[model samples]
Target: MKKRQRKVRLIRAAIQLVFFIVAPALFSTAFAGVKSIFQAIAAGQPVTWNSFLDVTGALLLITVLFGRHFCGYACAFGSLGDAMYELTLFIRQKVFHKKGRHGYPEKVVRCLQKVKYILLAFILLSIFTGWYANLQGMSPWDVFSMLTARKLPNASYKIGIILLVLILIGMCTQERFFCQFLCPMGAVFALMPILPSALFKRDRSKCPAKCGLCKKRCPAHLDIDGDTPLSGECICCHACEATCPRKNIQIGQEVEELKEEAAVSKTPVKREKSAAVSK
Candidate 1:
């Protein structure tokens, strides 16, 4: 509940809202622009310097430094997924009195998570094979774009609807299911080289026994007690820091301050020689 934390939450909310409401209308660019770039490269086109200034490039640079924060805070489909899942949760609780959200088995979920890599490879291969246009209809983000434009689909409409429905169901039952297991763009971000300038981190030394609140809050299901909080799957949402009851979790400069304190305390203070001993 610190002022800065509250500000961060507000900013996150505002970004999510903008993506949800204005992005489709204003930017008109689907969040899958990154995947399109890879497809273009697979087609043997020369990469241009201006390409580095596009949305995908900006997002790539951001992910390189800060992790997949864009997915958590600025993705339109991600915001929709969060809203749909929350609405489903409310309905399940109030209508069905459900206490638990169900999803694919953990083993199955892990296996499915690898499918994004396969999809990425398939897209690249299809581009090289000149079948990219035929398979592009299968993209959920393209479907998202079609839906955004309020245009009726020509052919692959049924497939698009089915995929969208499945995505909705997955979102309802599991947190960030698309980002975790299906987003090709997210796969790229997850593979990017990690920088040391990450924000979210935990002080496990200060954690109380039996406290796993951070784990419950983590949308990515990362083991927050590990040596570093900057996991490949991490979205840099800072939910762990916000949920920690012990207040041991730190982000940004707070982490540096804690390290400084630890270092200062560890430096031993030499005791002055007693006057009697000197005599």
Candidate 2:
């Protein structure tokens, strides 16, 4: 189980690195598609198929089919957040002799998660009102995109650079800080009507009473046992599945198989107890 968990993490990290280097602008590109549609609408122009639509449509289809795996393993900003958080963990553990990670209060995190949705609404309103055009150089993502493309931002990007710095600082303090609390793209993904079969599932009956190892390990602090709407905010990182000591969380065919195995394992104990009572 440990080996499998390590392998999953390694594969996810490698995928993240590849996407970070080769397609770091994917999130921004998809967002550009959304903006173009609204801008066209605001201008009374007919929407036509373009690269922006192509990218946006494709990603939305993928999210509906496979959950938010893109956010978990391919988004460049998410990769950057992961790197920053990992560095913080290293520093805390090695230099300060403290715990490698910190868990925020669940209530606080839940409230913070709503902020991205509000931001998304604000951005859409700006675009529809033509105010987005006046808000140039104010997006942290714009600064990140420029820096990743090896371009030095100009004076026009001062606000963006400042926001980027603050976001990076937040990233160091919390795992997936941007994805969890600030990313408009993440908010869009969360609102997607993802297929239930695509979302990870947990068998609460198999979980030890009072055990919340999976929730604690989740970067989004999601409740894996259906207490929360699993498809709403899950990024499909599978952290809960990997961290479960009972191996109770899974998706697809694996879920049914785990239940069968559990049933089989209990049959003998039940028979033994029955035999002892009869004797």
Candidate 3:
């Protein structure tokens, strides 16, 4: 790894460690503060502006710009998945490999995923349109807090167990399952379907054969050989670029840089001369 990338990965790993340790303890308080902030802002009540933004807006800002990497790398549940995954990998390698693995019911993952998007829309609408009560009742953070605090009901607790099971399943398969599939807070970030200012664009001209290095490294199952990933399903994990033996795969600062370089290389010298004369 380059020095800068190695440093970033190390920093990300450290932050993930801290979040894993500290967040569950703080989740309830975070819930209370965020609710208060949202209520204050929605009502246009006599609330300090700093306090409102600190609670309501700052969290969203960080989550949206950074991608759900914050969840995969910084969330408490993420740590749980990571720790469990290594053990599970060992067990499965030793035992379960011969017995075909089973996936958790995708019904809940796909259908319940839609529920978060709907809930997210409602929350934003309610917050902006003076109907804060609509959202306040459905905040998943509150659900998460209540579950963690041991105040959730028997049925709810069962459902939480199912969620935990699903999370484990995701770790064995996709690295960021809850963040990718379920968390309503993550719904906001996952919907930010923009090409990264910098991205791993396959150089088709240089790459003649169906090079397989990038795809093999991607945990998300993206076919990098095909084109830029269209599903917005990527977490910007650069494992593919890292493992490319051909070294054709790289993280670019912008798509434009690759385009400009391609254009410069392909242009005829006569065209440049003509353009210079015309100028």
In candidate 2, position 39 carries an lDDT of 84
Could you give candidate 2's per-residue lDDT for residues 1-279 as a string of tens digits?
778678888999999999999999999988888888888898899988899789889888999888889999999999999999988888889999997367577888888999999999999999888898878999889989998899999999999899999999999888899999999988988888877678777767788999998889888788874324645788888888888888788764345666888899999999999999999
Candidate 2 regions exceeding 4 Å error are 226-230, 253-258, 265-279
Between candidates 2 and 3, the TM-score winner: 2
User: How many steric clashes between backbone atoms does each model show?
Assistant: 0, 0, 0
Q: Which residues of candidate 3, in runs, are more than 4 Å off?
A: 1-15, 22-56, 59-68, 97-116, 119-162, 169-174, 193-195, 223-232, 255-279
TM-score of each: 0.78, 0.92, 0.57
Identify the candidate with maximal lDDT: 2
- Tens digit of per-residue lDDT, candidate 1, span 1-279: 456457766787788898777665222242345545665687677655443347667777887777677878877777777777778878988999988554566566667778877877777677777787786466666677678778766686667667877998889878778877887767777788766556556666667898777775677656663325337777777767776766667654455566676556655532233544576
Candidate 3 lDDT tens digits, 1-279: 455446655666677678756666333343344446566767788665554345435544554454335555656655555556555656776876744232344444445456557865666667768776543434444555565566764453554455555556766764455555555555655555444533456565555476665654454555554224333455555556665554456554444565566677768876988999999
In candidate 3 the C-alpha lDDT for residue 19 amounts to: 79
**Model 2 lDDT, residue 221, Cα:** 81
